[model samples]
Target: MEHEATRITGTDLDPEAAFQRRLGAVVQAVEERIAALLDDAPRRGEIARPARLVAAMRHAMLGGGKRLRPFLVIETAALFGVPFAHALNGACALELVHGYSLVHDDLPAMDDDDLRRGRPTVHKAFDEATAILAGDALLTLAFDVAADESSHTDPAVRAAFVQGLARAAGLGGMVGGQMIDLAAEGRYGDVLLDEARVRRLQAMKTGALIAFAVDAGALLGRAPLGDRQALGAYGRAVGAAFQIADDILDRESSAAAMGKRTDKDAGKGKATLVGVLGLERARRERDTLVEAAIAALASFGAKADILRSAARFTASRQS
Candidate 1:
């Protein structure tokens, strides 16, 4: 996945443009890998076959968005000189898990959204039952993708990938955070959660999977223990900053700009940094977190230039 910058390749381009070219390469690689994975899945005829479910899963997982999590996995893996093909399996697995989350999160019982990435959500495009099943299938398939022998020749590395993804995507991480989120908004019952509780919720719900993406890549590459720890810190800081930036965008931007509904958190009584710290302070905090995240990668030098750019983008993004 290394792109040598030459005059023919636009080495004369601005740093942002050059960086974007690299990012685009990662995006295209992962998208193609994911598509192939779906197309080649084990298919059986009727008698409870998964044709419709596969269709739903494919609809939700492919041809969309920034694919930032996959980029993190690929770039972190590259730090150890891992081949692009070696990283593709894990990158696609993480994207599947992310796609699953979004599918479930958009359910009528969850975020109750009608659109995602400017199209009808899985639940709306198909039916509520199909959406739920598609999400479940995606989550389960992620582990299978990680366990594939081609992902890593070493069984131990493959095992680590599976274990890491489960922990990050499970109760201690994203799903657990979603539970807290639902409760905080009184989906279960009334409860006045404080700033600390809300912050914890955001960290687990959003930050956990992101941290896993970076740290798991380091593990798959067998990077030094110290390097793995640093990447973990970077992931957590960037994850929090990402949520804060999302809050700002939801408050300040339009639905069309975001390609989804905006300004809905307040209506749902969701606790966000902007609500707790106010918009100005939240923006400052996000900026500070971005700096902290970039500092965590200082030891990597220019090898981690893409990661540094990612943190900066997370802090300043409008949608």
Candidate 2:
């Protein structure tokens, strides 16, 4: 049997390629803007203080990355008729939080990784203390950026955005996920965790920020409650798929391509779908989650074309 080829146009023109291209543009623009903002800080101008910490912070913040979370924020906002420019700062703030987490995660106390995004880990490039402070600064600055006047017009909206981000990045979200991951080492070898436990860990770790990214956009754009809920569902599904793909990639992708060390999960004895269900099954799970993500966007119609493409990219990306 011959399969029919699907035609794509406008926002549907090779969604993964389009997302990569658009994401590059967004990330570059945001990086430049953030750099300018960081330069304006009084600490940067002061030569008497230890600028190494600031430089380490900048190195980690400005390091090249896919900016996936930020891209979600921008694309989701566009689905609600909000312009990308209006959502840039919020997107940037999300990236800041993500970057900070990575910096801290690579520390000796955490993953003890020596490389990140093809560069030396913060703790390796700089001192451990400086890296810790850099991570701390970026985390704090994330909320500061979200609450800035330029990011939001209404105080209530700004407050909600800030709160959402804090929840995602704090103990209830990413931190909690990390705690679970750390605990699972060596213990998950023979333990068969149920679906609920898997979903709980993934939701707190990856889905939390992704959910925040989508919901923040809806909140900022003043989207309807139904639309917000739909986007949140989409974000959660995509986020889980993203992590699953990441787990697969950890086994298959090159360290250079990933911009981070690979095989760390297996080396650390961490629990992942791949470990529990085998590679083929894990891949199938990724596809299923991606479909759910796309289905969640059915309400947005053409307005969600970018997001749909992003969902496809989530399952297909090699790194």
Candidate 3:
């Protein structure tokens, strides 16, 4: 199975099956890493770990979605011949930040979501304060893991990971984009969401971290400047397509199908390409981005077919 799974040739087996096999491996590894990170035992320089806090953090991190961000890190690192073991912790760190974002995103003051991954959200399953703390802890733990020597041998690479992730999650990136999204909802005042503004919001909110995920792999392997730029392009294209696909899913998918509320984007007046470009055009744009993402990998040749498939899956994913 290991031999079969590592091979990415199109004719060797079913493409979707192979892609899913690789993805499942990443999800399993990330889940195990997260569980270990949230364990009851305190690490060096930490006080006693609180049981409830650990449980809340565990609930927010474990048994969740596709873990696509981690997959991108691991897979892209492999493109540069970096072993998965070397990349695993960094991948886990990125996913930890993603989990933290979702926990906070589902808060009463934010999207106010009740269900996530078909289960009660952190705030719903636990308490709001606990949920908030869990998010904070998860975000902090991400930096911990990224800073650890296990993530990379070079201090420079680890430092880059820390700085890059902070930038991706900080004011100029996901958090700022979230603020813009909320303001666009008329939470503060009237904010016109033209196509340009909508695209910018999505790029910052969703694209930044995703682009970081791919770039982290390049950093991990210390890839050349040109290769790094190529992966960056791929990540940006996929990231944009991802948000467009999400908006389309919100409009067209059922709550039961999505494991969360649907039809809420329009109701909240959230800035989305689907809202600005209409469903048909949004879909066309997504397809175009998928192609562009693939084209960005042209320099990597057959080694990047898995990534090419990933771009397709991102655009066409039902959930």
TM-score each candidate: 0.93, 0.90, 0.96
**Model 1 lDDT per residue over 51-156, tens place:** 7887898889886777878878877887887876788889889989999999999998989999888889999999999999999989988988899898899999
Taking the tens digit of each residue's C-alpha lDDT, what string does model 2 give over 1-319? Answer: 2111111224555565666677777777778767865663464334543468679888897858878788788777776666766788898999899989998899987889998888899999988999999889888878878988889778898898998898898899999998887777744355545667777887888778887888878888889889888888988898889888999999899998998889888888776888778899999999999999999989878767778878888888877
Q: Give per-candidate clash totals.
A: 0, 1, 0
Worst 10 residues of 1 by lDDT: 1-10
| Candidate 2 RMSD to the correct structure | 6.0
Clash pairs detected, candidate 2: 117-259
TM-score of 3: 0.96
Q: lDDT of all the models against the reference?
A: 0.85, 0.81, 0.90
lDDT of 3 by residue, 208-275 (tens): 99999999999999999999999999999999998899999999999888989999998888889988
The true-versus-predicted C-alpha distance at residue 78 of model 2, in Å, is 1.5
Name model 1 segments beyond 4 Å from true: 1-15, 40-49
